[model samples]
Target: MTELGYRHGEQHTPPPARRVTDVAVERFEHVFEVDPRLMTVHVAQQLFPNWDTLRIAAGRADHLDWMHRHWAHTVVSGQELLDDITGADADGPPGGP
Candidate 1:
Protein backbone atom coordinates (compact mmCIF):
# COMPACT_ATOMS: atom_id res chain seq x y z
CA MET A 1 0.00 0.00 0.00
CA THR A 2 1.11 3.55 -0.64
CA GLU A 3 1.48 6.16 2.14
CA LEU A 4 -1.99 7.44 1.24
CA GLY A 5 -3.35 3.87 1.51
CA TYR A 6 -3.67 3.40 -2.26
CA ARG A 7 -2.77 0.02 -3.78
CA HIS A 8 0.93 -0.66 -4.32
CA GLY A 9 2.80 1.52 -6.89
CA GLU A 10 -0.16 3.87 -7.29
CA GLN A 11 0.46 7.62 -7.16
CA HIS A 12 -1.66 10.22 -5.38
CA THR A 13 -1.52 13.99 -5.21
CA PRO A 14 -3.28 16.08 -2.61
CA PRO A 15 -5.58 18.93 -3.54
CA PRO A 16 -4.23 22.47 -3.62
CA ALA A 17 -4.81 24.78 -0.64
CA ARG A 18 -7.87 26.98 -0.86
CA ARG A 19 -6.92 30.35 -2.32
CA VAL A 20 -8.36 33.80 -1.49
CA THR A 21 -9.96 33.60 -4.93
CA ASP A 22 -12.06 30.65 -3.77
CA VAL A 23 -13.41 32.61 -0.80
CA ALA A 24 -14.19 35.56 -3.05
CA VAL A 25 -16.06 33.28 -5.45
CA GLU A 26 -18.03 31.68 -2.63
CA ARG A 27 -19.01 35.07 -1.24
CA PHE A 28 -19.98 36.32 -4.69
CA GLU A 29 -22.16 33.28 -5.21
CA HIS A 30 -23.84 33.60 -1.85
CA VAL A 31 -24.47 37.32 -2.16
CA PHE A 32 -25.38 37.47 -5.87
CA GLU A 33 -27.13 34.10 -6.32
CA VAL A 34 -24.46 33.00 -8.77
CA ASP A 35 -23.83 29.32 -9.33
CA PRO A 36 -21.45 27.85 -6.78
CA ARG A 37 -19.49 26.01 -9.46
CA LEU A 38 -18.93 29.13 -11.57
CA MET A 39 -15.25 29.78 -12.06
CA THR A 40 -13.56 32.79 -10.42
CA VAL A 41 -12.32 34.07 -13.75
CA HIS A 42 -15.89 34.18 -15.05
CA VAL A 43 -17.00 36.17 -12.02
CA ALA A 44 -14.15 38.61 -12.48
CA GLN A 45 -14.92 39.02 -16.13
CA GLN A 46 -18.54 39.66 -15.38
CA LEU A 47 -17.66 42.27 -12.80
CA PHE A 48 -14.84 43.77 -14.85
CA PRO A 49 -15.18 43.21 -18.59
CA ASN A 50 -11.94 44.98 -19.40
CA TRP A 51 -9.76 42.89 -17.06
CA ASP A 52 -7.99 39.84 -18.42
CA THR A 53 -7.58 36.57 -16.52
CA LEU A 54 -3.82 36.95 -16.07
CA ARG A 55 -4.16 40.49 -14.73
CA ILE A 56 -6.87 39.40 -12.33
CA ALA A 57 -4.79 36.53 -10.98
CA ALA A 58 -1.71 38.71 -10.69
CA GLY A 59 -3.56 41.26 -8.50
CA ARG A 60 -5.27 38.68 -6.27
CA ALA A 61 -2.64 38.70 -3.56
CA ASP A 62 -2.34 42.48 -3.43
CA HIS A 63 -6.14 42.90 -3.44
CA LEU A 64 -6.53 40.46 -0.59
CA ASP A 65 -3.91 42.28 1.44
CA TRP A 66 -5.68 45.58 0.81
CA MET A 67 -9.02 44.07 1.88
CA HIS A 68 -7.48 42.73 5.08
CA ARG A 69 -6.08 46.14 5.88
CA HIS A 70 -9.38 47.86 5.05
CA TRP A 71 -11.28 45.47 7.30
CA ALA A 72 -8.87 46.02 10.15
CA HIS A 73 -9.15 49.76 9.73
CA THR A 74 -12.93 49.57 9.57
CA VAL A 75 -12.98 47.63 12.85
CA VAL A 76 -11.06 50.40 14.54
CA SER A 77 -12.67 53.29 12.69
CA GLY A 78 -16.28 52.13 13.15
CA GLN A 79 -19.12 51.78 10.63
CA GLU A 80 -18.63 53.00 7.07
CA LEU A 81 -20.20 51.17 4.14
CA LEU A 82 -22.28 48.80 6.23
CA ASP A 83 -23.67 51.68 8.22
CA ASP A 84 -24.56 53.62 5.10
CA ILE A 85 -26.13 50.60 3.44
CA THR A 86 -28.21 49.82 6.48
CA GLY A 87 -29.12 53.52 6.91
CA ALA A 88 -27.56 53.67 10.33
CA ASP A 89 -25.61 56.87 10.59
CA ALA A 90 -22.94 57.61 13.17
CA ASP A 91 -25.03 60.38 14.74
CA GLY A 92 -28.16 58.22 14.86
CA PRO A 93 -28.97 55.64 17.49
CA PRO A 94 -28.13 52.00 16.90
CA GLY A 95 -30.24 50.38 14.16
CA GLY A 96 -31.84 53.75 13.40
CA PRO A 97 -32.35 55.03 9.88
Candidate 2:
Protein backbone atom coordinates (compact mmCIF):
# COMPACT_ATOMS: atom_id res chain seq x y z
CA MET A 1 0.00 0.00 0.00
CA THR A 2 1.33 3.40 -1.05
CA GLU A 3 0.07 6.89 -0.43
CA LEU A 4 -2.59 6.02 -2.96
CA GLY A 5 -3.73 3.08 -0.74
CA TYR A 6 -3.41 0.10 -3.08
CA ARG A 7 -2.65 -3.37 -1.75
CA HIS A 8 0.62 -5.00 -2.73
CA GLY A 9 3.51 -7.16 -1.49
CA GLU A 10 5.70 -4.63 0.29
CA GLN A 11 4.56 -2.07 2.87
CA HIS A 12 3.69 1.47 1.90
CA THR A 13 2.04 4.56 3.30
CA PRO A 14 -1.67 5.12 3.00
CA PRO A 15 -3.08 8.35 1.71
CA PRO A 16 -4.63 10.98 3.93
CA ALA A 17 -8.32 11.02 4.70
CA ARG A 18 -10.65 12.75 2.29
CA ARG A 19 -12.65 15.74 3.41
CA VAL A 20 -16.24 16.40 2.39
CA THR A 21 -17.09 19.45 0.38
CA ASP A 22 -20.39 21.09 -0.41
CA VAL A 23 -19.79 20.38 -4.08
CA ALA A 24 -19.42 16.67 -3.44
CA VAL A 25 -22.54 16.65 -1.30
CA GLU A 26 -24.48 18.38 -4.05
CA ARG A 27 -23.13 16.09 -6.76
CA PHE A 28 -23.92 12.98 -4.78
CA GLU A 29 -27.38 14.17 -3.90
CA HIS A 30 -30.08 12.01 -5.55
CA VAL A 31 -27.40 9.59 -6.77
CA PHE A 32 -28.70 6.66 -4.81
CA GLU A 33 -28.52 4.07 -7.55
CA VAL A 34 -24.72 3.81 -7.60
CA ASP A 35 -23.39 1.32 -5.08
CA PRO A 36 -20.63 2.40 -2.67
CA ARG A 37 -18.73 -0.75 -3.54
CA LEU A 38 -18.86 0.40 -7.11
CA MET A 39 -16.99 3.52 -6.09
CA THR A 40 -14.08 1.49 -4.66
CA VAL A 41 -14.10 -0.81 -7.65
CA HIS A 42 -14.07 2.06 -10.07
CA VAL A 43 -11.39 3.88 -8.12
CA ALA A 44 -9.33 0.73 -8.11
CA GLN A 45 -9.64 0.59 -11.85
CA GLN A 46 -8.20 4.07 -12.18
CA LEU A 47 -6.00 4.84 -9.19
CA PHE A 48 -5.37 1.52 -7.47
CA PRO A 49 -4.72 -0.49 -10.66
CA ASN A 50 -4.12 -3.98 -9.18
CA TRP A 51 -6.71 -3.78 -6.40
CA ASP A 52 -9.75 -6.02 -6.17
CA THR A 53 -13.37 -5.37 -5.12
CA LEU A 54 -12.63 -5.92 -1.42
CA ARG A 55 -12.14 -2.27 -0.52
CA ILE A 56 -14.81 -0.47 1.50
CA ALA A 57 -15.95 3.11 0.88
CA ALA A 58 -17.40 4.12 4.26
CA GLY A 59 -14.20 4.64 6.32
CA ARG A 60 -11.57 4.81 3.58
CA ALA A 61 -11.02 8.45 2.71
CA ASP A 62 -8.28 7.76 0.16
CA HIS A 63 -10.65 5.64 -1.86
CA LEU A 64 -13.21 8.38 -1.82
CA ASP A 65 -10.62 10.95 -2.85
CA TRP A 66 -9.49 8.84 -5.75
CA MET A 67 -13.10 8.27 -6.65
CA HIS A 68 -13.71 12.01 -6.69
CA ARG A 69 -10.65 12.60 -8.83
CA HIS A 70 -11.12 9.76 -11.30
CA TRP A 71 -14.43 7.92 -10.92
CA ALA A 72 -16.70 10.95 -10.94
CA HIS A 73 -16.01 11.63 -14.64
CA THR A 74 -16.92 8.11 -15.69
CA VAL A 75 -20.01 8.11 -13.48
CA VAL A 76 -21.26 11.39 -14.88
CA SER A 77 -20.60 10.36 -18.47
CA GLY A 78 -22.20 6.99 -17.98
CA GLN A 79 -25.21 8.57 -16.35
CA GLU A 80 -25.60 11.03 -19.19
CA LEU A 81 -25.43 8.28 -21.77
CA LEU A 82 -27.88 6.20 -19.82
CA ASP A 83 -30.23 9.12 -19.49
CA ASP A 84 -30.12 9.73 -23.23
CA ILE A 85 -30.73 6.08 -24.01
CA THR A 86 -33.51 5.87 -21.46
CA GLY A 87 -35.20 8.96 -22.87
CA ALA A 88 -34.98 7.61 -26.41
CA ASP A 89 -36.15 4.18 -25.34
CA ALA A 90 -39.16 5.66 -23.59
CA ASP A 91 -40.34 7.35 -26.79
CA GLY A 92 -42.33 5.31 -29.25
CA PRO A 93 -41.31 4.90 -32.87
CA PRO A 94 -41.50 8.16 -34.76
CA GLY A 95 -44.70 8.72 -36.72
CA GLY A 96 -44.78 10.79 -39.92
CA PRO A 97 -44.75 14.50 -39.00
Candidate 3:
Protein backbone atom coordinates (compact mmCIF):
# COMPACT_ATOMS: atom_id res chain seq x y z
CA MET A 1 0.00 0.00 0.00
CA THR A 2 1.12 3.64 -0.57
CA GLU A 3 2.18 5.81 2.37
CA LEU A 4 -0.69 7.61 4.17
CA GLY A 5 1.07 10.98 3.82
CA TYR A 6 0.08 12.80 0.59
CA ARG A 7 -1.46 9.60 -0.75
CA HIS A 8 -4.00 9.37 -3.51
CA GLY A 9 -7.75 8.88 -2.85
CA GLU A 10 -7.73 10.82 0.39
CA GLN A 11 -11.23 10.78 1.84
CA HIS A 12 -10.47 13.78 4.07
CA THR A 13 -9.99 16.11 1.08
CA PRO A 14 -12.57 18.89 0.96
CA PRO A 15 -14.47 19.98 -2.11
CA PRO A 16 -13.98 23.51 -3.40
CA ALA A 17 -16.56 25.98 -2.19
CA ARG A 18 -18.86 27.66 -4.67
CA ARG A 19 -18.81 31.46 -4.87
CA VAL A 20 -21.62 33.78 -5.96
CA THR A 21 -19.05 36.37 -6.98
CA ASP A 22 -17.55 34.01 -9.57
CA VAL A 23 -20.99 33.27 -10.90
CA ALA A 24 -21.69 36.99 -11.23
CA VAL A 25 -18.44 37.49 -13.12
CA GLU A 26 -19.27 34.65 -15.49
CA ARG A 27 -22.78 35.97 -15.98
CA PHE A 28 -21.36 39.46 -16.49
CA GLU A 29 -21.55 39.03 -20.27
CA HIS A 30 -25.29 39.61 -19.97
CA VAL A 31 -24.50 43.31 -19.70
CA PHE A 32 -23.18 43.49 -23.27
CA GLU A 33 -26.07 45.72 -24.38
CA VAL A 34 -24.51 48.42 -22.24
CA ASP A 35 -20.82 48.38 -23.22
CA PRO A 36 -17.59 46.39 -22.91
CA ARG A 37 -17.74 44.16 -19.81
CA LEU A 38 -14.55 45.35 -18.11
CA MET A 39 -15.18 48.98 -18.96
CA THR A 40 -18.67 48.84 -17.56
CA VAL A 41 -17.45 47.24 -14.34
CA HIS A 42 -14.72 49.85 -13.94
CA VAL A 43 -17.04 52.77 -14.49
CA ALA A 44 -19.63 51.26 -12.20
CA GLN A 45 -17.09 50.78 -9.44
CA GLN A 46 -15.99 54.37 -9.84
CA LEU A 47 -19.57 55.54 -9.50
CA PHE A 48 -20.52 53.21 -6.68
CA PRO A 49 -17.54 51.57 -5.08
CA ASN A 50 -19.48 50.38 -2.06
CA TRP A 51 -22.06 48.65 -4.23
CA ASP A 52 -22.20 44.86 -4.36
CA THR A 53 -21.13 43.36 -7.69
CA LEU A 54 -24.53 41.76 -8.21
CA ARG A 55 -26.32 45.01 -7.43
CA ILE A 56 -24.04 46.93 -9.76
CA ALA A 57 -24.61 44.48 -12.59
CA ALA A 58 -28.38 44.63 -12.22
CA GLY A 59 -28.44 48.40 -11.79
CA ARG A 60 -26.25 48.86 -14.86
CA ALA A 61 -28.59 46.84 -17.03
CA ASP A 62 -31.61 48.82 -15.90
CA HIS A 63 -29.99 52.27 -15.77
CA LEU A 64 -28.12 52.03 -19.07
CA ASP A 65 -31.14 50.71 -20.94
CA TRP A 66 -33.38 53.34 -19.43
CA MET A 67 -30.97 56.12 -20.35
CA HIS A 68 -30.42 54.72 -23.83
CA ARG A 69 -34.15 54.53 -24.50
CA HIS A 70 -34.99 57.92 -23.05
CA TRP A 71 -31.87 59.85 -24.02
CA ALA A 72 -31.64 58.26 -27.49
CA HIS A 73 -27.97 57.38 -27.23
CA THR A 74 -25.64 54.60 -26.18
CA VAL A 75 -23.61 55.91 -23.27
CA VAL A 76 -20.56 54.41 -21.58
CA SER A 77 -19.78 57.64 -19.76
CA GLY A 78 -22.02 58.26 -16.75
CA GLN A 79 -21.03 61.91 -16.54
CA GLU A 80 -21.84 62.49 -20.20
CA LEU A 81 -25.28 60.94 -19.76
CA LEU A 82 -25.83 63.10 -16.71
CA ASP A 83 -24.76 66.24 -18.55
CA ASP A 84 -26.84 65.49 -21.65
CA ILE A 85 -30.00 64.43 -19.86
CA THR A 86 -29.84 67.26 -17.33
CA GLY A 87 -28.72 69.91 -19.86
CA ALA A 88 -25.78 70.74 -17.65
CA ASP A 89 -22.80 72.63 -18.99
CA ALA A 90 -19.18 71.52 -18.79
CA ASP A 91 -18.76 73.61 -15.67
CA GLY A 92 -21.98 72.47 -13.98
CA PRO A 93 -23.21 69.19 -12.60
CA PRO A 94 -26.35 67.48 -13.89
CA GLY A 95 -29.69 68.48 -12.29
CA GLY A 96 -32.57 67.64 -14.65
CA PRO A 97 -33.62 67.38 -18.29
* Worst-scoring 10-residue span by lDDT in model 2: 24-33
The candidate maximizing lDDT is: 3
Ordered by TM-score, highest first, the candidates read 3, 2, 1
Better of 2 and 3 by lDDT: 3
Clashes of 1: 0
Candidate with the larger TM-score of 2 and 3? 3
Error of 2 at 28 (Å): 17
Candidate 2 ranges beyond 4 A from true positions: 1-55, 59-64, 70-82, 91-97
lDDT of the candidates, in the order given: 0.44, 0.43, 0.48
- Candidate 3 stretches with Cα past 4 Å from truth are 1-51, 73-97
Candidate with more favorable, higher TM-score: 1 or 3: 3
**Candidate 2 — which pairs collide?**
none
Cα misplacement distance, residue 63 of candidate 2 (Å): 1.5
As a whole number from 0 to 100, the lDDT of residue 95 in candidate 3 is: 54
Question: For candidate 3, what is the lDDT?
Answer: 0.48
TM-score of each: 0.21, 0.22, 0.26
**Cα RMSD for candidates in order:** 11.4, 13.1, 14.8
Let me know the TM-score candidate 3 reaches against the reference structure: 0.26
